[model samples]
Target: MPVSHPDPIWVTDNDTLATYCTQWLKLDAIALDTEFIRTDTFYPKPGLIQLGTGQEVFLLDPLKIDNWQPFAQLLGSEQVVKVLHACSEDIEVFHILSGNKPAAIFDTQLAASYAGLGHSLGYQNLLKTLLGVDLPKDATRSDWLQRPLTDIQVSYATLDVVHLLEVYQLLQQRLKPMPHWNWLLEDCSNLSNGDLYPKPEEQWKEVKRAWQLRPRQLCVLKVLAEYREREARRSNVPRNRVIPRGSLWPLARYMPDNIHSLSAIQDMRHSNIRHYGEEVLSLIEMARELPGEQHPKPLPAPLPKAAKEHGQRLKRYTSQKAEELNLPVELLMLGKILTPMLRSRLEYGLFKLPEQLQGWRRTVFAEPMVEQLNQPEQ
Candidate 1:
């Protein structure tokens, strides 16, 4: 059954937004969603922000309104539970807008992962699975930053929050008795902390093929990635527009020493070479002279065949644990991190478990995992 949606109140001014904020303070919870564009920019350009408080749905235009302090205050307050669906980018929009994140959020997507619905469930799918309402997603790729949003665009935005209220109620009821409820909240709080957003200095950890570089090359890659991050933010352009990943791989692998060498890189755009060639050469040269302690440790080789087989056993154990708890197997043991954990044992002769295997997992699954890995191959 489709729920009735209130005609959305168009919020074009701060005064209207302030009034809504006041009304919001009287409520115990609200659902939020944002529409933004970031095709050519490092940060999301928030196009429209939508909110639902059971009785009303409203659209606030980010292009016209400058003040979000009142809304920010309400979001940062413990007085209300902010509800969202797949809120990682929405959190970024707010963080960039108000310099603070929302308090006590419930992400429907994350909740579904723990609800045995499926991992990373889509919004419309969740609504259908829970409420039997299937909403059309016509504006999935619309350019929201444009002026004069069509009726379809506005309707799409409204649907984003219309069902969130009921979804939260249902998920809460389902989670009421589960011990992993705290785990869900913990994950949501971490998303709101903006900890997932890495600093420019730490960008190298996410670079593709990072482990391919030796220590000296690793130092160069780090500096180069950091430089790209800084420049992308400063210029407010896409990171690839600054320097492509294809360019970085060769430059790091060869450890180029001069502007000529940097220029000769196959994928370095002529524009990038013209602008940043000398600086690139200088960064690589400086990295060559850095102290050993400053360089990163080289990544060890992949695990051997026997250890790879043992990883399959560990995977089975993780799946059984997840099944017992009604959690997604991915939540308990991420295969990406698991690969490295198995390789870590191969190289270090002991477990160097991933972060997921620590914390709550240590008590729940890691102890058994350690025992399993320690036993000799059968």
Candidate 2:
């Protein structure tokens, strides 16, 4: 049985947290995790933070305290490594709540992928696979915001960080003997930078089918989406409640000029039309008047038979190489990575490979695969 630390520290205020941070800076690394919910709003509501060094574990009540300066300083400190598991959301939370992005990060999920354990291994699966311990799943959906958290809830939350530290230590030791340690670190540090979190309004144009629309349609969709996002933020309501993606298509397609035209459209609620009809129509009118190529053409049909054959050849070669390495083929050559290159090879003939098809991927898998594909069948 694993030894338990009965007296886990709980910091409910800023002053006590400051002292903890001062002490935490002395540690080599800390394991961190967060509990949050985003079901009702655009942003996550941070409930509790579980942090563990080798000697102690802490549960921080984010709702009770305002200042996180000391914790932020520790995160910004290059001396201490911040270890987390599949921590993309946790990283976002840190940025949103504290405005501090940790400089040094070690993500166990990334490490696991590089270690050939497969991509996106769940936390419980990882603990079992690496440590031979079966964790309880009872608290998976517990209401974290409720006060006087049950002892079992505390125990479950504490284990999230406590076992995380153990997993980090083992993975670090295992990865220390491998060639991809620096690469993993590079990737983790890149993830630590939070610049990618707050996506700009115009960038939403990249969503699927946005380019397929006429300029007027694109403009209408953009305005509706922007309104939905802004209203979601202002009202603290879910984006779908404000305006569903389903409604955007018809509005953009038909370009309704009034509430009657809008109401005639399917899947639009009468109450919603009464409330937002004019605003929606006004946006459509603005889009219709925007001067440019009004109607854009649809995307070209999929590649022909000859192109598909080449793609198959490339996929087969990559699969064989992945088998030799005992790794998942998708890890080395995902569909997104291969599709464009395959299409280019078919259309353009023997082009210089993309960067993704070069480097470690190429040397380990792509180059040999390309050679095999080029060789004529006996």
lDDT of each: 0.84, 0.76
- Give the clashing residue pairs of candidate 2, or none: none
In model 1, the runs with Cα more than 4 Å from the true position are: 1-4, 194-196, 257-260, 291-293, 347-359, 372-378
Which portions of model 2 miss their true places by more than 4 Å? 1-5, 194-212, 263-277, 293-307, 324-326, 334-336, 350-378
Could you give candidate 1's per-residue lDDT for residues 1-378 as a string of tens digits? 664467898899889888888989889899999999999898999999999987788899988888989989988988799999999899889888777799999999999998889999999899999999988899978999889999889999998898898899999999978877888888788777647456888777776778778888888888888998899889988888778877776777898887777778868888887877778888888887899899977755456687977687788888888888878988888666777778767777776676654456666777777777677868
Model 1 has how many clashing residue pairs?
0
The residue pairs in collision within model 1 are none
C-alpha TM-score for every candidate: 0.91, 0.85
Residue 313, model 1: Cα distance from true site in angstroms: 1.8
lDDT of model 2, residue 77: 93
